[model samples]
Target chain A: MSLSEFELIQRYFAEASTDASVALGIGDDCAVLSVPTGQQLAVSIDSLVQGTHFLEGTPADLLASRLFGSALSDLAAMGATPAWLTLALTLPEPDEDWLQLFSSRLAQLCNEYHVSLVGGDTTKGPLTLSAQVHGFLPRDHRLTRAGAKVGDLICVSGCLGDSRGGLDGLLNGFENHTEAGYLLERFYAPTPRIELGKILLGKANSCIDISDGLLSDLSHILKASGGLGARLQLEAVPISSQLIATFGEESARQWALTGGEDFELCFTLPPNYLALLSQLPVPVAVIGKVTDRADIELFLRGEPCQIQGSGYDHFQRKDD
Target chain B: MSLSEFELIQRYFAEASTDASVALGIGDDCAVLSVPTGQQLAVSIDSLVQGTHFLEGTPADLLASRLFGSALSDLAAMGATPAWLTLALTLPEPDEDWLQLFSSRLAQLCNEYHVSLVGGDTTKGPLTLSAQVHGFLPRDHRLTRAGAKVGDLICVSGCLGDSRGGLDGLLNGFENHTEAGYLLERFYAPTPRIELGKILLGKANSCIDISDGLLSDLSHILKASGGLGARLQLEAVPISSQLIATFGEESARQWALTGGEDFELCFTLPPNYLALLSQLPVPVAVIGKVTDRADIELFLRGEPCQIQGSGYDHFQRKDD
Candidate 1:
C-alpha cells in the first residue's frame, strides 16, 4: 500500500519523545507539553523555500539540517533552552527515499538538542518547510536585542563568513576543493550556538544570531537598543583559514562583514565581563564596541574604511 | 523605499497582544509566553498552499480566516483554550494591499478567539501560509480521540455538507447564485467550534474535528481509539438548508458524508450525558453510535447502504 499522510506520520514522524516535558507527542489533534513553573516558553517560526533558501541540488539530509538548525538558532538568540519543535512540510511529490533521509537527519538533530518533534503538518505543493521551535527560559532572563548599552563590548562566538564562502563555492562550482568542502558543510549545516547562548544569558547585554551578515544583524541590535551604533576593528573580525585561503584577506573580510547565514552569536557585554568570557568553552573575539553614534563605523589598520552594502534584503533585487 | 520584509512586518504585523500570557510579542528572535500553572500546552500546525489548499482567486481575507480557523480547530478538537499563534507566510511578492487585508482579518479572528499572534517569519516564495497555534488545558482534562468507548453516542456540532456544497459551487461557476452564497461562505470561512469543544471536555468520551469529511476524520478517531468502529445514521447526519437547496437530497447527503473542510467537532459521549448537550450554544446532532465492530457502517432508512469513498486523501489521486 502507498503511504498515506496518516501512515507517513505514524511510521516516520511519530517516534517516542524523550522529553519529559512533552506530555503527548504525535498522533493527536495537538501535542501536549508541560512548561515548568517559573519559566516562560519561547516560540519562533521560520520557513525555508526550495530555490529561495537552498539550491536545487541540496541533499535531503543537509536540507533538513539547515532548516532545523536555522530555526533553532532563533531559540539560541533568545537564550532559551530548546524543548520541542513542529514542522510543516510541503512537497511536489512524496519520495520515500527523500522522506527517510530528511526525517532521520531531523530526528538526529532533535536528539542531540533534547528537543521532541511534538506536532506538524504535511501537504502537497512546491518544496517548502516551515518549523516552529519552542524553548523555555527562566522568567525575565531572556537576552533581547534591545538591551545593548553604549559602553558594551561587542563580541562574537566563532569565525564568521564561512557559510557565505560555502555558498559562493557552491554557486561557482568549487565544491570539489577540500577548502570548499569545509565551507560547503558550514553553509549546509550551520551549528546553532545554543549552549553559548544559554551561558551568555545574564552576562550578555544584547544578542542576535548572524543570519543576515554581521552588519545587518548587528544593525538590528543597534536599532532595537535605541539608536546605538557600533565601531568595528576590521582586523579583529574573525575569518576562517579556509575562507582566507580560498578568497584572500580582502575578499574574506568583505564576506565576514556582509555574507549572511553564519549562525554565530553576536552579543554585547559590559567590559567588566570580558575576563569571564575567557572561561567560555568556545573561542570568542571582541570585534568592536558599542557606540553612541547612530551608524556603524569600520576601522582597518587604524584607518577609517568604507564598506559597501549592508546585508540581504528579501524584497530588494541584487542589482538595485 | 521598497517594502522590505522587516518594514512589512512592522507596518502590518506588530500589533499589541491582548493576551496577558504573552511576555514578549513580535520583533524578537522569539516570542515568550507564560502557561498558567497546572496546565499543559497544546500545539498544532497547519499549512495552506496555493492551488492545493486554496484557489488562485480566493479573497485574501477569506484565505486568512480559513487558514487560521482550520488550525484553531485542532485546538478545539483537543478541548484546549487558545492562547498564542505564529504565522510563517511565503509570498510571491510583497503586495501591500493583500498583506493588509490578510493581516487585519487574521488579527480580527485572533481578537475574537483571544489568541495572540506572538511571532512569525515572512519570506518571498510561492504563496504559502503556515500557522502554528498553541493552547492550554488542565493536565488531566484533555479530550483525545483515543478515549472513545464502544457504547458511547456519536454527535456532531453544526452542519456538515455546507462547506462541500460551497466548494462545488466555487468549482462549477455557481458561486454567484444567491442560494450558493451561504455554502460559499461556509467553505471559505468555516468557524471552529472552540466553545463547543470546551464544553465537551470531561463530558465527551472522545472528539475530533471534521476536516477531511466525516468518515475519513472519524476513521482517525477510530484508529486512535484501537479497534473501534461507528454506525452512522445517514438520515440523521446534519445537512444545511443551503446545501439541500443548491443540490437535491441525495447529492446533499453524499456531500455531508464525504465532503471535507467543515471544521465542525464530531465527538462521542456516554449515553447518560446526552441530555447535557442541550445546554450547548450551537446545534448538536446525534448522528450515530460507537460500534464494537472494527469498521464503520452506514444505514439509510434503517437499511444498510454501500458508500463509494470516505474523504480526501492528500497522496491519493482523485481517480484512484
Candidate 2:
C-alpha cells in the first residue's frame, strides 16, 4: 500500500498537540507563539535519520524517548525550562505501529517533563526525524559554558558509559537481571538531568550536559573560558558497579573516559556550594578541579595515565 | 569524497554572515534574538530539494533566489516586512563553486529584502535546503485568508500565468527572448509583493499569496471564509500580450489558472476600496466577484468554461 504525503500527514501526524504557549498550532502555514515575559526562549534542533543515526529494527519507543531526551538535555545545560517542541518526520513509508508507539512514548515523556507538543511536519521521504525543542531560561540567570574559573569544582551528576555498554551488550544478545543489565538500561533510557540543572542555576558558574562523554563536554567549558585546565582524579570518577563487574576495570575505564551519550550534567561551582551539592537528589561527583594553566591532566593516584581520545567526534573516522 | 558532518558545517557554513539583528548568530546551541516593539514578528519556513522542487542543473544563484523568494512570499501573504532568515543546508558533498555562488546570491537577496542572516545548520547529506524566514507586521493587522465577505470584490495583483509559460518553454528548450521567457523569469525570481501586502492590510479583507495559481489559492480563501462561489470574467484578468502571442489564448489561460509559483497577491475587498486601491504603487485587477453558490463559474463572452482542477493539487498529476 502506498500513501501520498497529504494522506500520510493526516493518518500519522495530523493531531496537533496543544500547549499553553502556542497561540496558534499546526494546520496553519506557520506557528504563532509567544515567549513568556522576563524569560528568553532557547531552541535546539536535532535530526535523526534511519541508518544514519540508529540501527535497523530499533524499538520505536526507545528511539522516541532517547532522541528527545538527548535534545532536551541541551536545554538542561543552559538551565532552561522545557516549553514546546515541533517534530519533522520524513519516513520511507507510513507505519501505523511505529507512529503509534513513537507518539505514545513522546507524548508520555512530554507530560512527565511538563513540556508540550506544539507543531510537526510529516512528509514522504527517507525515514528521518527532526525535533526542534523550545525552552525558556530566566532573563538574568542563564548558565553558559564560559564561566568556569580556576579552583572551581568540576561536578557531574549520574554515572557514565552505560549507553555505550548497553549497546554492546544488546548487540551481543546478552541480557541479565544483574547490575550490568541495569547499566544497559541506563544507556537505552538515559535520563535528562533537568532537576540537577535548575538546582545549579545560581550555584553553577558554568555547565554543559555530558552528551559526548565527560572529558570532551567538560573540555568545552574549559576551552570557552580560555586558558583554563582541569585536573581529574580517576578514582573519584563514579562508575556503576555493574559496569565494573561485567566489563571489568580496564574496559570500564575505557568506557568512563570515552563513553558517549551519557546525558549527565557536568557543571562547575565555587567552594560555597560544595555542601549544598551533597544534599541533592542525584549523585554529585567532584571528579576534578579547574586550573590556571591550559592543560587537562588526568591522575590515577598522582601518576599520569596515558590520555588518548575521549568521546566521539562527528568528524573522526571510525577506521582511523 | 566522503566528508564528516562537522567538517561540512565548519567549511561551508560557520561564516556568520553579519547583519544588524544578528547580535548572536550561528555556532551557538541556540540563536539569541531581539524583537523590536510596535511590530509583531511574522515567521515562515520552506524546504526545497533538488528534484522535489527544482531541476538538478538549475543555476545556483537562481536556486537561491527562488528558495528564499518562496519563503519571503509567505511573509507577504501575512502583510509583513522581511527581517531575518535561517537556512539549513544538507548536501551530498562539498562543492566550492556551488557554495560561493549560492551564498553570494542568497546574500544579495537577503540584503535586497532587508533580511539579515541569523542562524542555520549545515550537514553532509542529501541536497536539500530548508529555510525559515521572519519579519515584522503591524501589531493589530494581519492579512489572512479567512476574512472575505459575500459581496467583496475579488482583486489580484500583477499578471498571472507567466511562470507556467516559462516552465513550459524551459521544458521544450525553446530559447528566445520571447514573452514565455519573461514569464519563466517571473517564475524563477518571483518579486515578493511585500509592499503591496502591507498597503492592502485593512483594505483587503482576505488575502493569500498566489504561488499555487489563482483559482486554487482563491479556493482556499473561499473555503476558509465560508464563501459560496466566484464569478470570474476571463477577459478582465491582466495578462501579458507576449504570453497570448507565444502560448496562444488557450495555453495562456492554462498558465493563469495553474501556474504554481507566481507569488502574486490574490485578495478580496469591499468595492469602496476601489478608489483607494487604485492609488497604490502597483496595478490591481478586479477580475471577479463573490457569489452565493458553492461552485466557481468562469465566463468568457458570457459563455461558461469550467476549470476541473485546482492549481497543482498535491494529489493530482500536474501537466508538466
Candidate 3:
C-alpha cells in the first residue's frame, strides 16, 4: 500500500513532546510556543532541492542531518539558542525506509539541539526540503554581519574544506580512498556550533556561517559591515588533515578558500578580546584581520597573491 | 543577464523595516524579532509546488496571494495575530515580470496583515514556494482542535465550495463563464480570517481552518477532541451564489461538503456562545452540533444521506 501524507507524518514525525515551551507540536494547524520574556526570537529559513543541494543517491539519514545542520548554522551565526523548527518536505514518492531513517536522524538532532518540530507541510512533488529554525537570545546580545569594524580580528572555528573535499570525492568516485570517509562524514554531518555562537554573543562584532565558502560568506560580512575588507593569511586558514591526505595540500587549500558548505562559524572579534581565545572550548584561528579598505587581499608566506575566482555563484554556468 | 540569488532577493524582497518588533529583517543569517510579553508564539509552514498545489500558468500575483493566505490561515485557526513571515522560493529560472508581480502582491499582503518579511532563501530548482508564518497570542486564549466538547455548536466562517468551484473552472477551462471569475477569485485569493480568529479565541471551544473541505477538516477537530462526531445540517451549509450559478445547486452543495481549499475557519462553540455570533464581523453559519458518537452523520431535508467521499487525499489515485 502507498503511504499517505498524513500517515507519513503520524508514523515517522510525530513524537511525545519533552519541551515545556512547545505548547503544541505536530498535528496542529500551528505550533504554539512560549517565548521567554526579554528575549528576542531569531528565525531563519533554508530550502534544499534534490539535485541542487544533494546527490540523488545521498543517504536519507545523511540528508536529514545535513539539512538540519545547515539550517541551524544560521542560528549559530546569529548567536541564538536553538528553540523550534518547522520542516516542509516534498517527495516524489513515499518510501517507508527512507522516511524512517530521515525522521529518526531529524528527531535526534532536534533533541540534541533542544529544538521541537513544531508544524510543517508534507506534499508529493519533486524532492525538496525546507527548514525554518527559530531560536532566542537577548535583544542586545545577538550577533550580526553588520557589526564588524576595521582592525577587528577575523576568526573561524574548526577546520574547513573537508566538506568540499567530500563533495569532490563523491562526484569524482574517490570514495575508496582511506581518508575519504572522514571527509564524507564532514560533508554529510557538518556540525552547527550553537554553543560557540552563544559564547561569542557579546564578544564577536560580526558573524556568519561558512556555507558558500570562506571567501563568499566572509564577503557577506564585509559587505554588510559597510565597505570593510580583509587581508587573509593563506597558511593560517585551517584545512583538515584528512582533506590534505586525500586531495593533497594545494587542492585542499583551494577547497578551503573557495569550496562551500563548511557550516563553520566565521566571526570577528575586537582586539581586546584576543586574550579570551584560550578559554574557548573549540580551536579558533585568527586567519585574517578586518581592513579599512573595501578590497579583499590575500597573502601567502607574507607575499601578495591574486585569487583566481570568487566563491560559488548560484547563477554562474558550470563551465564559466 | 541571469538573475543571481542575491540580486533576486535584493531587488524584489528586501524592503525598509516598518515593523518595530522585527529587530533585524533580511540580509542576515537570521531575522531577530521581539515577541510580546505574556504571549505565546505560533508558527506554521506551507509549501506549494508547481503542478501539485497550483497550475503551471497561474498568475504570479494570484499564486503569491493564495500561498500567503493559505499559510496565514493556520495562524487564524490558532487565534494568533500574524507577525512575521519568511519565504523560501525555488524557481527553475528567473522571470523578472513574474517576480515583480509576486513580490508586490506578497508585500501588499504583509502590509495589510501587519507582518514583516524576515529572512529566507532563494535557489534555482523546480518551482516551489514555501512560506513560514509566525504569530503571537496570549497563552491561555489560543484555540486548538482538541478543545471541543460533545455539546458544542459547530460553525464555519464565510461561504464554502467557492474555491473548489474556482478550481474546477480553472482545471476544466470554463473560466470564461461570467460567474467563473468570482469562483476563480475565491480559489486564487481566499482571505485569511485573522480578525475572526482573534474574536473567537475565548468564545470558541475549538477551531480549525477549512482547507481539506469541511467534512475532512472538521473530522480532524472531532478526532482531536477525542472520538467526538458531528451531525452536519447539509442544507445549512453556506454555498456561494457564484459557485451555485457556475456549477449548479447539487454540485455546489457537494463541493461545499467535500471540496478543499476554502481557507475558512471552522469552530466549535458552547451552547451559550451562540448569542455572541451576532457580534461577529463576518457571517458564520452554525451548520451542526458536536456529538458523542464517533461517526459523522449528514442530514439533508431532515433525512440522513450517505457521503460518497471524504475529500482530496494526497496519495489517493486520481480515479479513486
The estimated TM-scores of all candidates read 0.97, 0.85, 0.96
Q: In CAPRI terms, where does candidate 1 land?
A: medium
Q: Residue A6, candidate 3: how far off, in angstroms? A: 6.0
Can you write out model 3's per-residue Cα lDDT over A50-154, one digit (the tens) per residue? 887788988889999999999999999999999888888888876778888888888888878878777778877899999998899986679999999999999
- For residues B249-289, could you state the per-residue lDDT of candidate 2 as single tens digits? 88778778777678888889988887977687778899899
Which candidate gets the maximum TM-score versus the true structure?
A: 1
Question: Across residues A60-117, which tens digit of lDDT does each residue of candidate 1 receive?
Answer: 8999999988999999999999999888988888777788888888888887888888
For model 2, the DockQ equals: 0.25
Clash pairs detected, candidate 2: A163-A187, B228-B293
Q: Candidate 2 has what TM-score?
A: 0.85
| DockQ scores of all models, one per candidate | 0.65, 0.25, 0.60
Docking class of 2: acceptable
What does DockQ come to for candidate 1? 0.65
Evaluate residue A288 in candidate 2 and report its C-alpha lDDT on the 0 to 100 scale.
90
The TM-score that candidate 3 achieves is 0.96
